[model samples]
Target: MARDYASRCSLSPVRKTWLAAAAAILLAFQGIGAQKVRVEEELEAYPTESVDLRCQFIDGLGKTKLTQVSWIWEPIDGQRDNIAVYHPIYGQSFPNLSFRDRVVFLQNSLENPSIRISKLRMADAGRYTCEYATYPSGNEQGTTTLTMLAKPKNSAKVVTVQAGSKSVVVAQCEAADGKPAATIKWLGSVGGNHSTTTANGPDGTVTVRSEYRLVPTPADNGRDVVCMVEQRTQEQPWVNTVKLSVEYPPSVVIEGYDNNWYVGRSDAALLCLASANPEPTTVTWTAASGSLPDTVMVDGNKLTVRKVDDAVNTTFICEAKNKHGASKHQITTIVIEALEDPSSAGVVAGAIIGSLLALLLVVALIAVLLTRCRRQQRRGYPSSGDSIATGSGGSNGGDYGNKARLLFSGTSNNGSKNGTGANNNGPIYTYREGCDATGTLTEKANDFHHHHLHHASVGNPPSAHDILLSGDIDEPERRKFDLDDSMEEEEERYDRFGGIPGGGNMLPPAYHVRRGHGGDEEVDVYLDDDMESQRDGSVISRTAIYV
Candidate 1:
């Protein structure tokens, strides 16, 4: 038994060594089969920023010695290329010229196998692959996708968008070259319908064009129209703005005057105001009827008044012109009234003056008629001789003939001779008293005593009784004497009584006579030729005679 036990112990050592070697081989095979490499499926970065693409081993052989590590990039439209390589003992290498200075190993270690790119660009977006070669493990690989996001490039232009029935365009906005199919919208001062058109680019980007149609009114002359672009990755939208300019004709209006106007008393002015897309270039003022005076001044849009007259009544036009079109406003001016014309006033004054002159001429004619009537009242009768006599000179005579001659003297009651002659002593008979067969006498005095005949042709003085008895002593000679007396009296009467009513001098009686036979007895008498008296006494005549 001792010999058998010793041999068994020595063989136990060899069996234990073989069993440990088998267990070691089995663990190594299991580790090689379970090796795994992992990488991120997607990554995101922006331009000019840093990004890390992850490629690392999640499960692999324990403490395996890695020989090689390499990175590859496959672009969306191009072939794959090696970006960088790593050898455990040698160092790192970058094989691709496109990513030479931009790619680097993370922490300068190959265990992680992650690449960090500095200053990323849009072109750098692609699929990245990492490969690893290790001792006891043949190969391991991982893939990651890198996506680059950039701000969209926005552009805008004003285009004529046809909308409604009118052939006019207000505004248009378009956005292009946006990633992830950017949404386009419009924001502006005016509200209207919009039309959108989208197109895909050769790259995986979308270009959006949006057209906004608007009907601009006068209130929307200058306004801002904006086109906004929105992407999935951006927080704030990209925008393109343009100022909209609308073109239209001018709307003209006139100011600075009311409707009430008067000639020669009203002052007025007119101003033109226009609204248009482009400012008005010229403003003109004109009249419809007559031409405006040279004194009227025009400055810019204002028409200033210099003088107002009857010619101011007309239609006024204010015209404004711009690039689009022209417009005009008309105002009719009228004259109400003024003071009376000077010529009419003068005519009225002349008529009043003529009326006053006619009244004065009528008054002067009346005054002349009244003076002539007063002169006729002063004379006793309608005289046919120059002088007048009134007296009581005859005494009553009984049974006298039908005709009797009365003697009178030529002298005035004021004791002054009337003519240029010497006084006569003899009594001159100037009148005859005639009685019919019934003894009724009528006094008839046809001639007055003439002062020129007082000194001539008085040869004898006859007594009153003898003059009454002698009827026809010498008929032809008495007729001759009466004719001469009438001629002399008529010539003297015209010389003294030119403008009086009766053809006789306007003076008092020239003689006084007594009606009784005695010289002391006297009677009152009147010198009217038509008066008659009857008495039963001798007739006597007395005359105050001058020698």
Candidate 2:
């Protein structure tokens, strides 16, 4: 009862008044109130799917005498038709029309009358009114609006066209034959304009088509364009992408010419490059003035100059041909006078580097020699109160030969000196005097002992002949002889008191002295006959020496 009252409240005043009168008459005859009737207020379904238009009557007042129930269709265009009906005695009836076999009552009785429609079409979308009539009460009806949905077939494609100034169709998108039209939109990274047109089908379906227009160019080739479609049947918008193909004639470019070609230059070449959708078929090289010179050699797109000369100083032309069209490029050649050889720079650089390295080597050698000389000078001479022994020996024999030795006594006392500036405090130096003497260390020591003892016998100091040559040899005389290179290479032997033992001597500074048998003074003398002076003012003998 409450459901029937609510449905009546939603209707117009005329409908409410008619329902109130029917309820009053039913109450007056049977002493029972009106019963609730229900029908789906709204219904939705897709194409070819079954849908149920529900209509039920509740006899809360105990069978208010239901006579007949019928299903009616009321389209939005005001066209009406009776599609289904149910009666107690006449049995189920589906009208003999478009919905004859496709629609029927779910139950063959009037208690809960509902209809099911099969093989539904887009035109089946309309208002369905389920009407009921009885002997006591009048008609009671409920209306439901049925909505149909469809998913459109979406597609997009790009059209190939030659490059032109005027605008033309470059891409297209379509959403075909969808219930309740689908919307289409164009999008891309490129710039263009699009137009949309819609058409309605006889079966109540709509088709939408969109075209994109743009000025075509070669640069637009392979660019992407997007098509987006929206419809009621899809949860999200459908999208498709297409690449544009724009064709054009061949474009040519020339490369590899520096314009510094000289008369004697070689290995000069130029290349011709062409860009097009279809690759170039033929490449030709020529001279702008006339035929190509004999100095030039052409290989496909490349032109090489064997030897740059006056003949190769003409403008060069390169032509490329393809199916679309032909294109050409040219470059002028300027030949200058032959300049200095390029390799000369490397030769001069190498020479300068070599000279600097040679100078550096010489300077390093001079530095090493000077350092050695200073160290030798400092070590060769001993100071006062110091003793030193220097000698040179060879492997020629066990006998000593032409030995030059220096011996220092640690005596600081001043003593009488000969013209050779001999002093008791000065070290004794042995001078070579060309004398050839050969003996072993012991024999030489014994002989020096005998000679020094003979000098000590007369109480006479060592004479100048013992330590100096006959006359002072000048610098020129010192360098006049060939000095022995192995003077310092020989072995030198020392005595028990190898150095001075803090003792004073009556003789002048001695040369190459050693301890004799019986603790006597001994000296290893150098003979002047076998001696030669070096450029450094030092004397060396070619003969081997001992001790």
Candidate 3:
């Protein structure tokens, strides 16, 4: 009902359910009209595990009346056969012989008009239709469908028996079903030893059984004989396990691993040397060569190994008997060998490689950081002009010459000096008169007096380039002082006739150039010591104020 309410279904069951619903619903729905005959059917008094065929109809007034109900059966050949399975109105009720003792109509004739049938058979699995007609009016009637399902069977039981018993013993296998056909079997413990055990009767229904007959004996106990039962050809079969106990002392003894084994193994076998009511017994090893492992272990009913050594060449044997008889089997040996560890090497190698890769990555990162630090340090500016001042003596000259030379010789930078008194990395020059800076000095300056005393009285220094006697040439002097390449600004702007913007830009302390006319007092040139910027331009123009 829950499955149907979900409005979903499977192939076989759902088809049958809906078809039954259609038949029953049709009978019920048609009774709504006037003067109609309604049918209600049911079964009574049948054995357990049988089908109860049923149908019911209720009109507007809800009354009950006996009527001639029509019943039909459609064989697989598709022929519709009318069967008087039951008809209360005509003072007659006939059922199919196929039903025989298999069904009983429990419907009461005197007081009730309903037809009830009981006692089910698997053959009753089919569709049955009932049609009820009214008095003096066969035309008006209602019909319902009936379905009978065979009852299921009880579980199967298994039994076991042993070899060589003196007396015959009967093994009985039983299972219950409701008119359900059953098959029985007598099975042997070993493979391919099965017999189609015959049941008591032809139909094989009601009570079905199989038996194993053995004469009275002490050796018949603790042997397996199983019974299996399956209902329909398609149902999954079920089985049982039973051990038959024989009354005699044990014989034909054998012992080994409960499971199977492969080739080349060390095994201990407890063999059966004798068989009888009172079996004979003793233990020992047997083979072409009586070779056995130096190490052998034994317990009450078991043999084991603390270690399985391949050097032992695996062989063991045991002999068994009661007071009756004895037998022997080849020694069973179990083989085993050492297995090397496979994953450890690969795991270790991977770890080593990964560690190396990670360490290399860290080292590379550290190198990059150090290079950046050096670059920053190289760009660091000195706080004052004297930060790198170096002292020097005059270049073999006098007072005015001495002081100037002393000031300008050697270096003002931390590195070595060039001939021009500038830092090491540059082109140097000595003053020459009207000679292009391209010219070389006739001789290096041994005396500074030549340079400072250009307009002085008395003789000029000997290495005299006419530059010493030249006119008041401040132009060349200043031009010679080109801005350092490291300066923040280029030197080109200084050549614009010295009208360069002289002070702070954009913010306060702004330079007002006074817009000096061409006629103004001779320009007072001021060279900024803060920067040697003009590689020939203005003083350095620091792009943005640092502080």
Candidate 4:
């Protein structure tokens, strides 16, 4: 019915043209929406693996029709070639001989035709176009880029070199046979520079190489260096560490010469120390002034003087030689007269010093003892030429009233004086006042001495035996005397107990003393044959008194 209406309705030429152009524009928009093709623009696969190059045709409104589909290989350096084809009548076909056995069409339909290629090689990496022939849309195509990935084998090695002034290769790193060229770099604190180079293989793989350069020295030996390689196939950079080896000539040093080589010494030796990469081949000893002395012996790097003498005094040269070079060291020897044994000299000096120290200590002890004795005597006795007399009481000869003239022999006095004359032997302390306690007697004597000293100031100081005594003394001085007296009493007790307090000695000395008792005084006298007489006609005795 629409066709009959269109034929009956006639139009002018201009109107017909306008209607035709509108119809054509409406059909083009419909074809654009009805037919669409899709393909992966970029794909990646490893070598020797299979990959699907997908191609799909979409028909909207069920109006667009597909006839045939084909895959074309567009190499980067060559013209296009048909690799795979599919048609509704002819089935699947592959024309390229290289991919004839490895490629196949995935779908038989003309709408969605995809090809799978197996056992891919590096040469197969290029652009591929999926072309489709349709009923109304004519030819529709999409392109895909197939990329092949190949991992490179990386390795690094160190080069052994002799020490030199010029720069040389010390280490090398390589990334071999990769699909894309790999980048190489050197890493380390070896203070060296690196250079990179590339190589092309016939199989479309690239090889990258790098070398580390440096002026190597002996100090650089066993130094660590690293090489790194980066490639598309690896997620992380490949790393390798290596150690460099360097050789150098010998360095020499001399040892074992203590500069104490004296005449008549035995078994003295000098040693030569040499260090080198290659061991030293020879060691020789030579004299600087003349031939080696007869007493000297040479063995390897050691020179020994069996019996040292005046002839052994000379300069010695030691040369250590190797294939690389030679190093020399020298030492001069000086001989002297035979020296005494140091141990003997040390012993003699120590003995002399010890004797002198002991003598000094004894002299100091004697001086201290003499000073203490003089101080004690001054407190206990009166000096020479001082006379002391009893105070007058009732003018009669009572026990404490008589003007008695007393003569006392003290440690500081040569003799005693009385109204009769001088007496060589007399009582040292004569107290008319009787006291039962020794302490009370000492107190009374001290008081009497002080009182008499005050009264006798007009003349010389009164002797304790000549006047009534008064007591007035510093508290500190009195305490000091009390302390000295207590210490002396303790020492006497210790001596009586055989040098160990409260213990008795099994064997005692034969020395003896007889103590005489007066009214209030202690008189001890020693009568022994070994007594020695003094200038005052009194004898000093070594007496031991036992309590």
Candidate 5:
């Protein structure tokens, strides 16, 4: 459980859910009272829609007598006294010849007569005064002026873009046959540098565009943008305006030179890029448990660590901040060992080694005791079983030698070789020099016994015993023999010694005996060479290899 806890220590689900919901609510509230309208803050940018203007209060009984209301205009240059007149009372429209068919108003409802002046010319682009005479309680007159200035047919276009990338921005202001083509204005949140111009066409047509771009950030995500279309003859700053909404999302990234490589002292860098539509205000770095270096430096999209040292092993943190909120990154660890000190670990290492050595000694002593006890159990009849114990007699035939004779079960108390042979009628002589080992070998013979003697042709065969590997079985270079091969080989090899046949099953690393194929003759001569000897002629055996 402790391991699992260390594996994950981060934000939980409930906190994350609450934070997200809160952020969404705050953004919605920011937009509630932000919608507004104006005439010409920036004329080059505007939304395309139907034109609607209602002058309802101009006549106090606004909707009544809607049919009686009409319009009139005077021609420019005094070419005629009255350019045109629409009189619902006369049920007639009389137009001066010079201004004939030049104007029409399609709307009624006691609103302002929204007139469309056709074949508009430079002289037509002037103050258009709407004169109203109302019969509401008293006679009253009022006027509102709309200066008809030549304006562009199309507003400057706006383009959407992603944050944290380089880009180019360009827009054109164009119109056909306006008195003087509109001027283009480019506006944004920050430094908006733009070039303006007019490309003249036949008959005073004009094309004007603004050219500019900037690398955007999250802070630039949704900024109110505007472009102005200024007409030369207009008294106001602009004849029309266009509003642009630039939308880009928050972008966070790691950028650097060889960021994943092991960074070095002076030639390395770490770049943390934090950008958002609403615009982040600040960026910072922190250490998990230590102070951040004083030499650290930051730029718009980059955070750099200078002259890193061994102390750089501390965890590093990145933070991005703005007025709305802030975000932090998970701690990332870096280890810096300036130079390895081989001798520094000697003291603690010595203590660990000493403890392990003491443990090994205790384990070895317990293992020895267990081994001796098990061996005694397996050899219940050892005193009568071990025989032909051939060795160079250090003190010939003494009490110890007599004990050896009794252990073989060969000689009787009267110093006669007891016979379990065909010549059991009398005492038997032991084999020439082998008698000292078994107190003597039996002279009672059979062809099978002669075959068994062939195995002992040399001096004395090695004692039937098992040997362990030089060290632990876990050593890679000293791979062990498979249990099955070791056991099978042990049984076959043990038959060469004097161990009797028909013992119960034995595990590997143990000595045992078995009868020959016929199962009638007991093969007492087993040939196990494995011993504690570890001698020059030790034979190696394993399943993974073949000889």
Candidate 6:
């Protein structure tokens, strides 16, 4: 009956207001009990890592004794599902088929009721709530958000696009299996044009590919090209880099020599330098004109000249070779002036002849001087003066005229006089004006006659011209004889009889007469044997007589 009256009775406006106030007070108390369960607002974890959805009872809240712990999952676009539940008497239970073995409840203490999700997946990333039931404080609930991150797999590759074009390639960068769509970018030495594409994977992941078309030059060789992947959850971007290699032909250069080269010297060297990707396998030296000298020696890049000469004045070519190609450089060896000029045979011959002629002239002059010295020695006289006498001589009484005669008698087979004529018995008469130092001239005359006879007894005799020349004297009182008119007659007589005018082969004889110291008295007379033999010998000698 009290329940019927209370159900039929209507309260006034003030009583209704009081009843609403009472209800509000009860709701406020329940809200305070719900606030006692504490949970994190957000939670973050990687895929394959564990995530905890915690719910705890606040201390001093009068809800210390726990009865039940229930966990639920709310997806982004799906219905709420029960994940796990626990009661002290019943242990733990998984209510959702999808999260059955992946969810667990923590029961370290009655005050804390938290659920952990192991090996979290993209599907597990959602809002989770935990509800706690206490005996005296009723039930309290908390919610937490779970975030799962999956890193993208990044790769980079450089592939050759064509043959004979190693310098050109395609640089490709890819990012796969990313939870969210990944952004791919090409950096670091990528040049020219490039393109990007994105794909969705079956496992709710994204894949991004970036292909950069590159035409690399020689300068870009060995450089790095990078591909980077950017994702929302990653702090550092994913990077992939590739290095480039380039090949080319050889570059040839010659060094170690200059224009200051010369012949007959060892002052120059030639060096061959080749710059190539692959080092040159061979180096050679050659001449453009003449053949290479035997003195040239090659040691790697160095070409040494053992001796330089005219043969080296040609174009020298240095050839270098490698796998790529061959290259050559040519240089002309310089030649300088020689130290000695060349002379012709004619000039040399002329010099020799002139030297010989001068030598002959010198020899001839020496011979002439020697002959003069010998003649002076044989004459027993000084070369340039007459001999002085210690005494003076006066004229003698005997006839001593300047007439010389030569008589020759024809000989029979018996080597004796063949005729008994008056000329044969008497001495041939010869007159001279000169007188001996003795008062008589008979001894001087006898001496000259005996010399002539003795020479005639030998084979040779003086001609009539020589007899007449010997008779002439240089004294002021003597007569001068003219030979031009009478030379023919004397020559005729010499040819007819082979002798002088006396008819005997004898040369003109000479005499020397010395005077006595007291007066013009006879001292001595001597015949010269050289005058009897040599037709050119001096014919007169005199000595002074003291007064």
- Highest TM-score: give the candidate number: 2
> Candidates' lDDT values, in order?
0.60, 0.68, 0.41, 0.69, 0.42, 0.60
What TM value does model 5 have? Answer: 0.23
User: lDDT tens digits, residues 39-97, model 6?
Assistant: 99998777778877778778564536778878878886577887788777887788788
Better of 3 and 6 by TM-score: 6
Candidate 3 yields a Cα-based lDDT of 0.41
lDDT of 3 at 179: 41
Query: How well is each residue in 1-547 modelled by candidate 1, as lDDT tens digits?
Result: 9999988767577899998999999999887566467788899887789898887765533677677889989986578899999887788899998799999988566678788999887778789989888767678888888887765667777753312345355656555655666788888757756788888765455677777677766665567788887887778987888666666778899887776555554367778888866789888888886577564678888876665566767777888898778999988776667565544788989989998898998899999998776653322223233222222354333322212334343332223222111223324433332334333323433232342223122312223223333453356535423433443454365464343376533322332121322132112222233222223211222221111
Q: Cα lDDT for residue 36, model 3?
A: 45
Lowest-lDDT window of 10 residues in candidate 3? 398-407
**lDDT ranking, best first:** 4, 2, 1, 6, 5, 3
| lDDT for model 6 | 0.60
Candidate 2 has a TM-score of 0.59
> RMSD per prediction, one decimal?
27.4, 14.2, 26.0, 16.3, 29.5, 24.1
Assess candidate 3 and give its TM-score to the true structure. Answer: 0.25
Q: What is the Å distance of residue 74 in model 1 from its true position?
A: 1.3
Q: Which stretches of candidate 2 lie over 4 Å from their true place?
A: 1-36, 257-270, 278-284, 289-314, 321-325, 332-547
Better of 2 and 6 by lDDT: 2
Best by lDDT: 4
TM values, all candidates? 0.51, 0.59, 0.25, 0.58, 0.23, 0.42
Model 4: CA > 4 A from native: 1-35, 87-97, 100-112, 136-138, 188-191, 216-219, 222-225, 263-271, 279-281, 289-312, 336-338, 342-547
Tens digit of lDDT per residue, candidate 5, span 61-135?
244243333333433434324343334555435355644565555554334444445555434322233334444
- Give the range of the ten consecutive residues with the poorest summed lDDT in model 1: 538-547
13-112 in candidate 3: lDDT tens per residue?
8789999999988877664556344443432222335544444443455454545555565433466665454444354545556644544455644223
Give the per-residue lDDT digits (tens) of candidate 2, residues 11-120: 78898999999998877866323435687789889889999888887676574788999998976667889888888999888775899989988888787898899999
